[model samples]
Target: MSAAPHTPAPKNLGRTALICAGVAMGMTGLSFAAVPLYDMFCKATGFGGTPMTGTAGAGKVLDRTMAVRFDANVAPGLGWTFTPESPDISLRVGETKTVFYKITNKSSRASTGIASYNIAPEKGAAYFVKIQCFCFTEHTLQPGESLEAPVVFYIDPEIAGNRELDGMKAITLSYTYFASKAGQPLAQGGTAPAKGDAATSNL
Candidate 1:
Protein backbone atom coordinates (compact mmCIF):
# COMPACT_ATOMS: atom_id res chain seq x y z
CA MET A 1 0.00 0.00 0.00
CA SER A 2 3.10 2.24 0.27
CA ALA A 3 5.57 3.31 -2.36
CA ALA A 4 8.13 0.62 -3.18
CA PRO A 5 11.18 0.95 -0.95
CA HIS A 6 14.26 2.27 -2.69
CA THR A 7 17.23 -0.12 -3.11
CA PRO A 8 20.91 0.79 -2.98
CA ALA A 9 22.73 0.44 -6.30
CA PRO A 10 24.60 -2.83 -6.73
CA LYS A 11 27.85 -0.94 -7.34
CA ASN A 12 27.53 0.97 -4.06
CA LEU A 13 26.74 -2.16 -2.09
CA GLY A 14 29.74 -3.97 -3.56
CA ARG A 15 31.99 -1.01 -2.77
CA THR A 16 30.92 -1.00 0.87
CA ALA A 17 31.58 -4.72 1.19
CA LEU A 18 35.05 -4.35 -0.32
CA ILE A 19 35.90 -1.56 2.06
CA CYS A 20 34.91 -3.64 5.07
CA ALA A 21 36.92 -6.60 3.79
CA GLY A 22 40.00 -4.45 3.31
CA VAL A 23 39.63 -3.04 6.80
CA ALA A 24 39.39 -6.52 8.30
CA MET A 25 42.53 -7.66 6.47
CA GLY A 26 44.45 -4.61 7.63
CA MET A 27 43.39 -5.14 11.23
CA THR A 28 44.52 -8.77 11.13
CA GLY A 29 47.93 -7.82 9.76
CA LEU A 30 48.39 -5.16 12.41
CA SER A 31 47.50 -7.58 15.19
CA PHE A 32 50.17 -10.00 13.97
CA ALA A 33 52.82 -7.27 13.72
CA ALA A 34 52.11 -5.59 17.05
CA VAL A 35 54.28 -7.78 19.26
CA PRO A 36 57.52 -7.69 17.27
CA LEU A 37 57.05 -4.02 16.50
CA TYR A 38 56.60 -3.16 20.14
CA ASP A 39 59.61 -5.23 21.11
CA MET A 40 61.83 -3.46 18.58
CA PHE A 41 60.59 -0.10 19.75
CA CYS A 42 61.26 -0.92 23.39
CA LYS A 43 64.76 -2.31 22.76
CA ALA A 44 65.60 0.74 20.71
CA THR A 45 64.27 3.34 23.13
CA GLY A 46 64.40 1.38 26.40
CA PHE A 47 60.72 2.05 26.91
CA GLY A 48 58.91 0.12 29.66
CA GLY A 49 62.02 -0.79 31.68
CA THR A 50 63.76 -2.47 28.77
CA PRO A 51 67.52 -1.88 29.01
CA MET A 52 69.60 -1.02 25.98
CA THR A 53 72.09 -3.52 24.62
CA GLY A 54 75.69 -2.46 24.17
CA THR A 55 78.34 -4.09 22.07
CA ALA A 56 81.22 -2.52 23.98
CA GLY A 57 81.96 -0.25 26.92
CA ALA A 58 81.04 3.45 26.79
CA GLY A 59 84.81 4.11 26.61
CA LYS A 60 84.37 7.18 28.82
CA VAL A 61 83.80 7.10 32.56
CA LEU A 62 82.25 9.78 34.74
CA ASP A 63 83.28 10.72 38.25
CA ARG A 64 79.69 10.32 39.40
CA THR A 65 78.82 6.85 40.57
CA MET A 66 75.61 4.98 41.35
CA ALA A 67 74.85 1.88 43.35
CA VAL A 68 73.04 -1.03 41.65
CA ARG A 69 71.18 -3.56 43.77
CA PHE A 70 70.65 -7.10 42.54
CA ASP A 71 67.46 -9.04 43.06
CA ALA A 72 66.78 -12.61 41.96
CA ASN A 73 63.79 -14.94 41.93
CA VAL A 74 62.89 -18.45 40.82
CA ALA A 75 59.53 -19.20 39.27
CA PRO A 76 57.61 -22.15 40.77
CA GLY A 77 58.41 -25.62 39.36
CA LEU A 78 61.87 -24.52 38.25
CA GLY A 79 63.22 -26.11 41.43
CA TRP A 80 66.21 -23.82 41.44
CA THR A 81 67.73 -21.46 43.96
CA PHE A 82 69.13 -18.32 42.36
CA THR A 83 71.14 -15.64 44.12
CA PRO A 84 73.52 -12.89 43.22
CA GLU A 85 77.08 -13.19 44.41
CA SER A 86 76.79 -9.80 46.11
CA PRO A 87 73.81 -7.83 47.25
CA ASP A 88 74.89 -4.76 45.34
CA ILE A 89 77.77 -2.86 43.84
CA SER A 90 78.67 0.79 43.19
CA LEU A 91 80.48 1.88 40.08
CA ARG A 92 81.21 5.01 38.10
CA VAL A 93 78.94 5.84 35.20
CA GLY A 94 80.23 4.38 31.93
CA GLU A 95 82.52 2.04 33.90
CA THR A 96 82.18 -1.56 32.80
CA LYS A 97 81.57 -4.11 35.56
CA THR A 98 80.76 -7.76 35.79
CA VAL A 99 78.62 -9.49 38.44
CA PHE A 100 77.86 -13.14 38.93
CA TYR A 101 74.64 -15.00 39.76
CA LYS A 102 74.54 -18.47 41.22
CA ILE A 103 71.84 -20.94 40.14
CA THR A 104 71.52 -24.36 41.68
CA ASN A 105 69.10 -27.11 40.72
CA LYS A 106 67.70 -28.68 43.85
CA SER A 107 65.37 -31.11 42.11
CA SER A 108 66.25 -34.76 41.83
CA ARG A 109 66.27 -34.62 38.02
CA ALA A 110 67.93 -32.52 35.38
CA SER A 111 66.22 -29.21 34.65
CA THR A 112 66.54 -26.38 32.15
CA GLY A 113 65.73 -22.77 32.75
CA ILE A 114 66.25 -19.31 31.30
CA ALA A 115 66.44 -15.94 32.98
CA SER A 116 64.59 -12.72 32.23
CA TYR A 117 65.71 -9.38 33.64
CA ASN A 118 64.70 -5.77 33.82
CA ILE A 119 65.71 -2.50 35.43
CA ALA A 120 63.73 -0.56 38.02
CA PRO A 121 63.26 3.21 38.40
CA GLU A 122 62.09 3.00 34.80
CA LYS A 123 63.45 6.48 34.18
CA GLY A 124 66.99 5.10 34.21
CA ALA A 125 66.40 2.27 31.76
CA ALA A 126 67.36 4.30 28.75
CA TYR A 127 70.78 4.97 30.23
CA PHE A 128 71.40 1.44 31.49
CA VAL A 129 73.16 -0.89 29.07
CA LYS A 130 74.17 -4.50 29.14
CA ILE A 131 77.34 -5.51 27.30
CA GLN A 132 76.95 -9.19 28.12
CA CYS A 133 74.32 -11.15 29.95
CA PHE A 134 73.25 -14.70 30.61
CA CYS A 135 69.59 -13.84 30.37
CA PHE A 136 67.36 -15.23 27.62
CA THR A 137 69.61 -18.25 27.33
CA GLU A 138 68.94 -21.76 28.52
CA HIS A 139 71.05 -23.49 31.14
CA THR A 140 70.74 -27.09 32.21
CA LEU A 141 71.76 -28.34 35.62
CA GLN A 142 71.69 -31.82 37.08
CA PRO A 143 70.52 -32.51 40.58
CA GLY A 144 72.49 -30.65 43.22
CA GLU A 145 74.50 -28.94 40.47
CA SER A 146 75.07 -25.20 40.30
CA LEU A 147 76.09 -22.71 37.66
CA GLU A 148 77.67 -19.30 38.09
CA ALA A 149 76.62 -16.86 35.38
CA PRO A 150 77.99 -13.41 34.78
CA VAL A 151 76.45 -10.17 33.60
CA VAL A 152 78.56 -7.39 32.12
CA PHE A 153 77.09 -3.93 31.98
CA TYR A 154 77.62 -0.20 32.37
CA ILE A 155 75.51 2.88 32.88
CA ASP A 156 75.70 5.30 30.01
CA PRO A 157 77.57 8.47 30.85
CA GLU A 158 74.73 10.38 29.23
CA ILE A 159 72.77 9.82 32.42
CA ALA A 160 75.13 12.14 34.21
CA GLY A 161 73.87 14.98 32.03
CA ASN A 162 70.18 14.22 32.48
CA ARG A 163 68.87 16.62 35.09
CA GLU A 164 65.89 14.36 35.74
CA LEU A 165 68.14 11.66 37.26
CA ASP A 166 70.60 13.97 39.03
CA GLY A 167 69.11 13.03 42.41
CA MET A 168 68.77 9.31 41.67
CA LYS A 169 71.35 7.43 43.75
CA ALA A 170 70.70 3.79 43.00
CA ILE A 171 69.05 1.44 40.49
CA THR A 172 67.82 -2.10 41.00
CA LEU A 173 68.52 -4.87 38.53
CA SER A 174 66.11 -7.76 38.96
CA TYR A 175 66.03 -11.20 37.37
CA THR A 176 63.56 -14.09 37.36
CA TYR A 177 64.30 -17.58 36.21
CA PHE A 178 61.62 -19.61 34.46
CA ALA A 179 61.37 -23.05 32.98
CA SER A 180 61.63 -22.94 29.19
CA LYS A 181 61.69 -25.42 26.36
CA ALA A 182 63.23 -23.13 23.75
CA GLY A 183 66.17 -20.71 23.68
CA GLN A 184 69.86 -20.73 22.89
CA PRO A 185 71.30 -24.12 23.77
CA LEU A 186 72.83 -24.45 27.19
CA ALA A 187 75.93 -22.29 27.63
CA GLN A 188 77.63 -24.95 29.72
CA GLY A 189 76.60 -28.46 30.77
CA GLY A 190 77.82 -30.97 33.28
CA THR A 191 76.64 -33.75 35.53
CA ALA A 192 76.17 -33.42 39.25
CA PRO A 193 79.59 -33.50 40.84
CA ALA A 194 80.77 -36.03 43.39
CA LYS A 195 80.66 -34.87 46.99
CA GLY A 196 84.39 -34.06 46.95
CA ASP A 197 84.71 -33.15 43.25
CA ALA A 198 86.81 -30.06 42.62
CA ALA A 199 84.74 -27.11 41.50
CA THR A 200 85.60 -25.20 38.34
CA SER A 201 83.68 -21.97 39.09
CA ASN A 202 84.05 -19.46 41.93
CA LEU A 203 81.66 -16.88 43.29
Candidate 2:
Protein backbone atom coordinates (compact mmCIF):
# COMPACT_ATOMS: atom_id res chain seq x y z
CA MET A 1 0.00 0.00 0.00
CA SER A 2 3.06 2.30 -0.34
CA ALA A 3 1.55 3.95 -3.35
CA ALA A 4 2.67 0.99 -5.54
CA PRO A 5 6.31 1.92 -4.92
CA HIS A 6 7.05 5.64 -5.22
CA THR A 7 8.73 6.55 -8.49
CA PRO A 8 11.00 9.59 -8.91
CA ALA A 9 10.26 11.97 -11.81
CA PRO A 10 12.83 11.81 -14.60
CA LYS A 11 14.76 15.08 -15.12
CA ASN A 12 15.60 16.13 -18.67
CA LEU A 13 18.61 18.12 -17.49
CA GLY A 14 20.42 17.56 -20.76
CA ARG A 15 17.45 18.77 -22.81
CA THR A 16 17.01 21.84 -20.61
CA ALA A 17 20.70 22.69 -20.82
CA LEU A 18 20.69 22.24 -24.58
CA ILE A 19 17.66 24.50 -24.96
CA CYS A 20 19.32 27.20 -22.86
CA ALA A 21 22.55 26.86 -24.79
CA GLY A 22 20.68 27.19 -28.08
CA VAL A 23 18.90 30.32 -26.91
CA ALA A 24 22.18 31.81 -25.72
CA MET A 25 23.87 31.06 -29.01
CA GLY A 26 21.01 32.55 -30.95
CA MET A 27 21.18 35.73 -28.89
CA THR A 28 24.93 35.88 -29.34
CA GLY A 29 24.53 35.60 -33.09
CA LEU A 30 21.95 38.33 -33.11
CA SER A 31 24.17 40.57 -31.04
CA PHE A 32 27.13 39.98 -33.32
CA ALA A 33 25.03 40.72 -36.38
CA ALA A 34 23.24 43.71 -34.90
CA VAL A 35 25.84 46.29 -36.00
CA PRO A 36 25.88 45.12 -39.61
CA LEU A 37 22.10 44.84 -39.63
CA TYR A 38 21.82 48.33 -38.22
CA ASP A 39 24.23 49.61 -40.82
CA MET A 40 22.15 48.04 -43.53
CA PHE A 41 19.01 49.56 -42.12
CA CYS A 42 20.61 52.98 -41.87
CA LYS A 43 21.97 52.72 -45.38
CA ALA A 44 18.57 51.68 -46.63
CA THR A 45 16.45 54.12 -44.65
CA GLY A 46 18.96 56.81 -43.62
CA PHE A 47 17.31 56.44 -40.28
CA GLY A 48 18.74 58.84 -37.71
CA GLY A 49 21.08 59.58 -40.53
CA THR A 50 24.74 59.44 -39.49
CA PRO A 51 26.44 61.90 -37.20
CA MET A 52 29.97 63.07 -37.84
CA THR A 53 31.46 63.37 -34.40
CA GLY A 54 34.25 65.89 -33.90
CA THR A 55 37.26 65.72 -31.62
CA ALA A 56 37.11 69.41 -30.72
CA GLY A 57 36.69 69.86 -27.00
CA ALA A 58 33.39 71.01 -25.50
CA GLY A 59 32.72 74.76 -25.45
CA LYS A 60 35.34 75.18 -28.14
CA VAL A 61 34.76 77.64 -30.94
CA LEU A 62 34.79 76.25 -34.46
CA ASP A 63 35.17 78.26 -37.70
CA ARG A 64 35.43 75.69 -40.37
CA THR A 65 33.06 74.39 -43.05
CA MET A 66 32.85 70.65 -43.41
CA ALA A 67 32.01 69.30 -46.86
CA VAL A 68 28.64 67.59 -47.10
CA ARG A 69 28.43 64.62 -49.42
CA PHE A 70 25.48 62.82 -50.99
CA ASP A 71 25.22 59.32 -52.40
CA ALA A 72 22.33 58.04 -54.50
CA ASN A 73 21.45 55.33 -57.00
CA VAL A 74 18.89 55.70 -59.76
CA ALA A 75 17.10 52.87 -61.47
CA PRO A 76 18.47 51.79 -64.84
CA GLY A 77 15.62 53.46 -66.62
CA LEU A 78 15.67 56.57 -64.46
CA GLY A 79 17.86 59.64 -64.54
CA TRP A 80 18.18 61.80 -61.44
CA THR A 81 20.28 64.68 -60.17
CA PHE A 82 20.63 65.83 -56.58
CA THR A 83 22.77 68.57 -55.12
CA PRO A 84 22.93 70.76 -52.06
CA GLU A 85 22.20 74.36 -52.87
CA SER A 86 24.19 75.38 -49.83
CA PRO A 87 26.66 72.56 -49.39
CA ASP A 88 29.21 74.73 -47.64
CA ILE A 89 27.91 76.76 -44.73
CA SER A 90 29.59 78.70 -41.92
CA LEU A 91 28.39 78.83 -38.35
CA ARG A 92 29.67 80.68 -35.27
CA VAL A 93 29.22 79.83 -31.63
CA GLY A 94 25.53 80.06 -30.65
CA GLU A 95 24.35 81.19 -34.05
CA THR A 96 21.63 79.40 -36.00
CA LYS A 97 21.62 79.15 -39.77
CA THR A 98 19.69 77.37 -42.48
CA VAL A 99 20.93 75.98 -45.77
CA PHE A 100 19.04 74.72 -48.81
CA TYR A 101 19.57 71.60 -50.93
CA LYS A 102 17.97 70.80 -54.25
CA ILE A 103 17.04 67.51 -55.91
CA THR A 104 15.72 66.93 -59.39
CA ASN A 105 14.50 63.92 -61.31
CA LYS A 106 14.83 64.20 -65.07
CA SER A 107 13.85 60.69 -65.96
CA SER A 108 10.35 59.65 -66.97
CA ARG A 109 10.08 57.28 -64.01
CA ALA A 110 9.06 58.30 -60.53
CA SER A 111 11.65 58.15 -57.74
CA THR A 112 11.21 57.90 -53.96
CA GLY A 113 13.38 57.60 -50.84
CA ILE A 114 14.61 59.27 -47.65
CA ALA A 115 17.53 61.69 -47.04
CA SER A 116 19.46 61.61 -43.76
CA TYR A 117 22.62 63.51 -42.76
CA ASN A 118 25.41 64.19 -40.26
CA ILE A 119 27.73 67.09 -39.46
CA ALA A 120 31.54 67.24 -39.42
CA PRO A 121 34.59 69.30 -38.30
CA GLU A 122 35.53 66.66 -35.75
CA LYS A 123 35.69 69.49 -33.19
CA GLY A 124 32.21 70.87 -33.51
CA ALA A 125 30.21 67.78 -32.68
CA ALA A 126 28.51 69.45 -29.72
CA TYR A 127 26.81 72.14 -31.77
CA PHE A 128 23.04 71.96 -31.96
CA VAL A 129 22.35 70.86 -35.52
CA LYS A 130 18.91 70.19 -36.94
CA ILE A 131 17.91 69.15 -40.38
CA GLN A 132 14.48 69.65 -41.84
CA CYS A 133 15.81 66.25 -42.88
CA PHE A 134 13.95 63.87 -45.16
CA CYS A 135 15.71 60.72 -44.00
CA PHE A 136 13.85 57.70 -42.63
CA THR A 137 10.96 58.57 -44.95
CA GLU A 138 9.93 58.06 -48.54
CA HIS A 139 9.87 60.85 -51.11
CA THR A 140 8.53 60.54 -54.62
CA LEU A 141 9.63 62.71 -57.49
CA GLN A 142 8.07 62.62 -60.90
CA PRO A 143 9.83 63.21 -64.19
CA GLY A 144 11.57 66.57 -64.31
CA GLU A 145 10.62 67.15 -60.71
CA SER A 146 12.80 69.29 -58.51
CA LEU A 147 12.72 69.98 -54.78
CA GLU A 148 14.64 72.08 -52.29
CA ALA A 149 15.67 70.72 -48.93
CA PRO A 150 16.67 72.91 -46.05
CA VAL A 151 18.73 72.25 -42.92
CA VAL A 152 18.68 74.49 -39.86
CA PHE A 153 21.45 74.31 -37.29
CA TYR A 154 23.30 76.25 -34.63
CA ILE A 155 26.44 76.08 -32.55
CA ASP A 156 26.00 75.48 -28.86
CA PRO A 157 26.95 78.44 -26.69
CA GLU A 158 29.04 76.11 -24.61
CA ILE A 159 31.54 75.97 -27.41
CA ALA A 160 32.90 79.40 -26.52
CA GLY A 161 33.58 78.37 -22.95
CA ASN A 162 35.60 75.28 -23.76
CA ARG A 163 39.31 75.93 -23.30
CA GLU A 164 40.15 73.60 -26.16
CA LEU A 165 37.69 75.37 -28.43
CA ASP A 166 39.16 78.76 -27.66
CA GLY A 167 40.26 80.66 -30.77
CA MET A 168 38.19 78.24 -32.83
CA LYS A 169 36.18 80.33 -35.21
CA ALA A 170 34.06 78.00 -37.35
CA ILE A 171 32.86 74.45 -38.01
CA THR A 172 31.34 72.98 -41.14
CA LEU A 173 28.34 70.64 -41.09
CA SER A 174 28.23 68.03 -43.83
CA TYR A 175 25.62 65.56 -45.06
CA THR A 176 25.95 62.48 -47.32
CA TYR A 177 22.90 61.30 -49.24
CA PHE A 178 21.77 57.87 -50.42
CA ALA A 179 19.07 56.82 -52.87
CA SER A 180 16.97 53.70 -53.13
CA LYS A 181 16.92 51.43 -56.19
CA ALA A 182 13.86 53.29 -57.39
CA GLY A 183 16.21 56.26 -57.19
CA GLN A 184 16.59 56.84 -53.49
CA PRO A 185 17.63 60.37 -52.49
CA LEU A 186 21.10 60.85 -51.01
CA ALA A 187 23.41 63.65 -50.01
CA GLN A 188 26.09 64.72 -52.50
CA GLY A 189 29.36 65.40 -50.62
CA GLY A 190 31.02 66.61 -47.45
CA THR A 191 31.34 70.27 -46.38
CA ALA A 192 34.58 72.08 -45.74
CA PRO A 193 35.11 75.08 -43.51
CA ALA A 194 35.77 78.39 -45.10
CA LYS A 195 39.15 79.99 -44.56
CA GLY A 196 39.49 83.08 -42.28
CA ASP A 197 35.99 82.80 -40.86
CA ALA A 198 35.30 84.67 -37.61
CA ALA A 199 33.29 83.66 -34.57
CA THR A 200 30.05 85.41 -33.69
CA SER A 201 28.08 86.15 -30.56
CA ASN A 202 26.62 83.24 -28.68
CA LEU A 203 22.96 82.51 -29.36
Candidate 3:
Protein backbone atom coordinates (compact mmCIF):
# COMPACT_ATOMS: atom_id res chain seq x y z
CA MET A 1 0.00 0.00 0.00
CA SER A 2 1.24 3.41 -0.81
CA ALA A 3 2.63 4.88 2.38
CA ALA A 4 -0.34 6.35 4.04
CA PRO A 5 -0.45 9.90 2.88
CA HIS A 6 1.35 11.88 5.45
CA THR A 7 -1.35 13.39 7.54
CA PRO A 8 -1.74 17.05 6.67
CA ALA A 9 -0.31 18.22 10.01
CA PRO A 10 0.45 21.63 8.52
CA LYS A 11 -3.26 22.31 7.89
CA ASN A 12 -4.14 21.47 11.48
CA LEU A 13 -1.22 23.57 12.74
CA GLY A 14 -2.34 26.61 10.75
CA ARG A 15 -5.87 26.46 12.20
CA THR A 16 -4.54 26.18 15.73
CA ALA A 17 -2.24 29.16 15.19
CA LEU A 18 -5.15 31.30 14.01
CA ILE A 19 -7.23 30.41 17.03
CA CYS A 20 -4.38 31.27 19.39
CA ALA A 21 -3.78 34.59 17.63
CA GLY A 22 -7.45 35.56 18.01
CA VAL A 23 -7.41 34.75 21.72
CA ALA A 24 -4.25 36.77 22.26
CA MET A 25 -5.73 39.78 20.51
CA GLY A 26 -8.86 39.52 22.64
CA MET A 27 -6.81 39.43 25.82
CA THR A 28 -4.79 42.45 24.76
CA GLY A 29 -7.94 44.46 24.13
CA LEU A 30 -9.31 43.49 27.52
CA SER A 31 -6.13 44.64 29.24
CA PHE A 32 -6.29 48.03 27.54
CA ALA A 33 -9.94 48.55 28.53
CA ALA A 34 -9.54 47.46 32.15
CA VAL A 35 -8.34 50.74 33.60
CA PRO A 36 -11.19 52.87 32.33
CA LEU A 37 -13.71 50.20 33.18
CA TYR A 38 -12.43 50.12 36.75
CA ASP A 39 -12.59 53.88 37.01
CA MET A 40 -16.20 53.92 35.95
CA PHE A 41 -16.94 51.20 38.45
CA CYS A 42 -15.41 53.16 41.32
CA LYS A 43 -17.27 56.32 40.41
CA ALA A 44 -20.56 54.51 40.30
CA THR A 45 -19.90 52.98 43.73
CA GLY A 46 -18.40 56.13 45.30
CA PHE A 47 -15.30 54.13 45.86
CA GLY A 48 -12.90 56.58 44.28
CA GLY A 49 -13.50 60.14 45.29
CA THR A 50 -10.68 62.21 46.65
CA PRO A 51 -10.01 60.70 50.02
CA MET A 52 -10.56 62.97 53.04
CA THR A 53 -7.38 63.71 54.88
CA GLY A 54 -7.78 65.08 58.39
CA THR A 55 -4.83 67.40 58.16
CA ALA A 56 -4.30 71.10 57.63
CA GLY A 57 -3.05 72.41 54.32
CA ALA A 58 -3.65 69.11 52.60
CA GLY A 59 -5.27 71.25 49.93
CA LYS A 60 -4.21 74.76 50.77
CA VAL A 61 -4.32 78.06 49.00
CA LEU A 62 -2.01 80.97 49.54
CA ASP A 63 -2.88 84.34 51.16
CA ARG A 64 -6.51 83.63 52.03
CA THR A 65 -8.55 82.84 55.10
CA MET A 66 -11.62 80.58 55.17
CA ALA A 67 -14.10 80.23 57.98
CA VAL A 68 -14.65 76.62 58.94
CA ARG A 69 -17.76 75.14 60.42
CA PHE A 70 -18.17 71.77 62.02
CA ASP A 71 -21.63 70.25 61.90
CA ALA A 72 -22.68 66.76 63.01
CA ASN A 73 -25.88 64.76 62.54
CA VAL A 74 -27.31 61.34 63.37
CA ALA A 75 -30.07 59.27 61.78
CA PRO A 76 -33.28 57.77 63.20
CA GLY A 77 -32.41 54.13 63.69
CA LEU A 78 -28.88 54.62 64.91
CA GLY A 79 -30.01 54.20 68.51
CA TRP A 80 -27.53 56.90 69.29
CA THR A 81 -27.35 60.60 70.07
CA PHE A 82 -24.56 63.06 69.18
CA THR A 83 -23.53 66.54 70.23
CA PRO A 84 -20.67 68.85 69.45
CA GLU A 85 -18.11 69.32 72.15
CA SER A 86 -16.58 72.47 70.69
CA PRO A 87 -18.06 75.57 69.13
CA ASP A 88 -19.93 74.51 66.03
CA ILE A 89 -17.91 77.05 64.10
CA SER A 90 -14.37 78.39 64.02
CA LEU A 91 -11.93 80.37 61.93
CA ARG A 92 -8.80 78.81 60.55
CA VAL A 93 -6.58 78.96 57.54
CA GLY A 94 -3.81 76.56 56.61
CA GLU A 95 -4.14 74.86 59.96
CA THR A 96 -6.01 71.74 61.05
CA LYS A 97 -7.91 71.55 64.31
CA THR A 98 -9.79 68.75 65.93
CA VAL A 99 -13.42 69.08 66.95
CA PHE A 100 -15.07 66.72 69.34
CA TYR A 101 -18.51 65.17 69.09
CA LYS A 102 -20.06 62.84 71.61
CA ILE A 103 -22.06 59.82 70.53
CA THR A 104 -24.28 57.99 72.97
CA ASN A 105 -26.33 54.94 72.21
CA LYS A 106 -29.70 55.46 73.89
CA SER A 107 -31.36 52.25 72.90
CA SER A 108 -30.95 48.80 74.39
CA ARG A 109 -30.02 47.30 71.08
CA ALA A 110 -26.47 47.27 69.84
CA SER A 111 -26.03 49.56 66.89
CA THR A 112 -23.50 49.83 64.12
CA GLY A 113 -23.29 52.41 61.35
CA ILE A 114 -21.18 54.73 59.24
CA ALA A 115 -21.23 58.49 58.50
CA SER A 116 -21.03 60.56 55.28
CA TYR A 117 -21.05 64.29 54.56
CA ASN A 118 -20.46 66.99 52.00
CA ILE A 119 -19.65 70.69 52.06
CA ALA A 120 -21.92 73.46 50.89
CA PRO A 121 -22.11 75.43 47.58
CA GLU A 122 -21.08 72.14 45.93
CA LYS A 123 -18.05 73.80 44.44
CA GLY A 124 -16.40 74.14 47.82
CA ALA A 125 -16.35 70.39 48.13
CA ALA A 126 -13.01 70.33 46.39
CA TYR A 127 -10.84 72.96 48.08
CA PHE A 128 -12.54 74.53 51.07
CA VAL A 129 -12.80 71.69 53.56
CA LYS A 130 -11.22 68.54 54.87
CA ILE A 131 -12.81 66.11 57.28
CA GLN A 132 -11.31 63.61 59.69
CA CYS A 133 -14.61 61.87 60.03
CA PHE A 134 -15.49 58.68 61.88
CA CYS A 135 -18.11 57.47 59.45
CA PHE A 136 -15.23 56.73 57.16
CA THR A 137 -15.31 53.48 59.04
CA GLU A 138 -18.01 51.53 60.76
CA HIS A 139 -18.70 52.17 64.42
CA THR A 140 -20.14 49.48 66.63
CA LEU A 141 -21.77 50.45 69.89
CA GLN A 142 -22.99 48.17 72.59
CA PRO A 143 -26.27 48.82 74.34
CA GLY A 144 -26.23 52.26 75.96
CA GLU A 145 -22.62 52.77 75.03
CA SER A 146 -21.39 56.34 74.87
CA LEU A 147 -18.22 57.61 73.31
CA GLU A 148 -16.57 60.65 71.82
CA ALA A 149 -15.30 61.00 68.25
CA PRO A 150 -13.12 63.79 66.97
CA VAL A 151 -12.89 65.27 63.49
CA VAL A 152 -9.77 67.21 62.62
CA PHE A 153 -10.12 69.43 59.59
CA TYR A 154 -9.01 72.71 58.05
CA ILE A 155 -9.98 75.18 55.37
CA ASP A 156 -7.83 75.93 52.37
CA PRO A 157 -6.44 79.43 52.67
CA GLU A 158 -7.53 80.12 49.12
CA ILE A 159 -11.16 80.41 50.14
CA ALA A 160 -10.56 83.53 52.19
CA GLY A 161 -9.34 85.47 49.20
CA ASN A 162 -11.93 84.17 46.77
CA ARG A 163 -14.66 86.80 46.43
CA GLU A 164 -17.10 84.16 45.38
CA LEU A 165 -16.95 82.54 48.84
CA ASP A 166 -15.95 85.64 50.78
CA GLY A 167 -19.14 86.11 52.78
CA MET A 168 -19.64 82.43 53.44
CA LYS A 169 -19.61 82.17 57.21
CA ALA A 170 -20.33 78.50 57.67
CA ILE A 171 -19.92 75.13 56.02
CA THR A 172 -21.82 72.29 57.62
CA LEU A 173 -20.20 68.85 57.92
CA SER A 174 -23.12 66.60 58.79
CA TYR A 175 -23.35 62.87 59.41
CA THR A 176 -26.14 60.35 59.49
CA TYR A 177 -25.70 56.86 60.86
CA PHE A 178 -27.09 53.94 58.92
CA ALA A 179 -27.59 50.37 59.97
CA SER A 180 -24.56 48.24 59.19
CA LYS A 181 -26.37 45.30 57.71
CA ALA A 182 -24.78 42.44 55.85
CA GLY A 183 -21.49 43.92 56.88
CA GLN A 184 -22.08 46.84 54.53
CA PRO A 185 -22.34 50.32 55.94
CA LEU A 186 -25.33 52.44 55.03
CA ALA A 187 -24.80 55.45 52.77
CA GLN A 188 -25.92 59.05 53.43
CA GLY A 189 -26.47 60.78 50.09
CA GLY A 190 -30.19 61.43 50.38
CA THR A 191 -31.71 64.85 51.09
CA ALA A 192 -31.18 65.73 54.71
CA PRO A 193 -34.41 65.91 56.63
CA ALA A 194 -35.82 69.37 57.35
CA LYS A 195 -36.24 68.26 60.92
CA GLY A 196 -33.95 65.78 62.55
CA ASP A 197 -35.08 62.28 61.75
CA ALA A 198 -35.36 60.06 64.81
CA ALA A 199 -32.01 58.61 63.80
CA THR A 200 -30.37 61.87 62.73
CA SER A 201 -29.22 65.11 64.27
CA ASN A 202 -27.87 68.46 62.98
CA LEU A 203 -25.73 69.49 65.92
Top of the candidates by TM-score? 1
> How many pairs collide in each candidate, listed in order?
0, 43, 11
Question: What is the Å distance of residue 74 in model 2 from its true position?
Answer: 9.3
The TM-score obtained by model 1 is 0.80
Which regions of candidate 2 are displaced past 4 Å? Answer: 1-15, 18-78, 181-203
Q: Which of candidates 1 and 2 reaches a greater TM-score?
A: 1
Model 3 earns a TM-score of 0.59
Stretches off by above 4 angstroms in model 3 are 1-66, 129-131, 187-203
Per-model TM against the reference: 0.80, 0.54, 0.59
lDDT of candidate 2 over 143-188, digit per residue (tens): 8888887655555665556688675554444443344444334333
Where is model 1 more than 4 Å wrong at Cα?
A: 1-9, 181-203
lDDT of each: 0.80, 0.50, 0.59
Q: Report how far off residue 80 is in candidate 1 (Å).
A: 0.6
Q: Candidate 1, overall lDDT?
A: 0.80
lDDT tens per residue, model 3, 134-196: 754677889889888877776666555568866666555555556666544443453433222
- By the lDDT metric, which is better: model 2 or model 3? 3
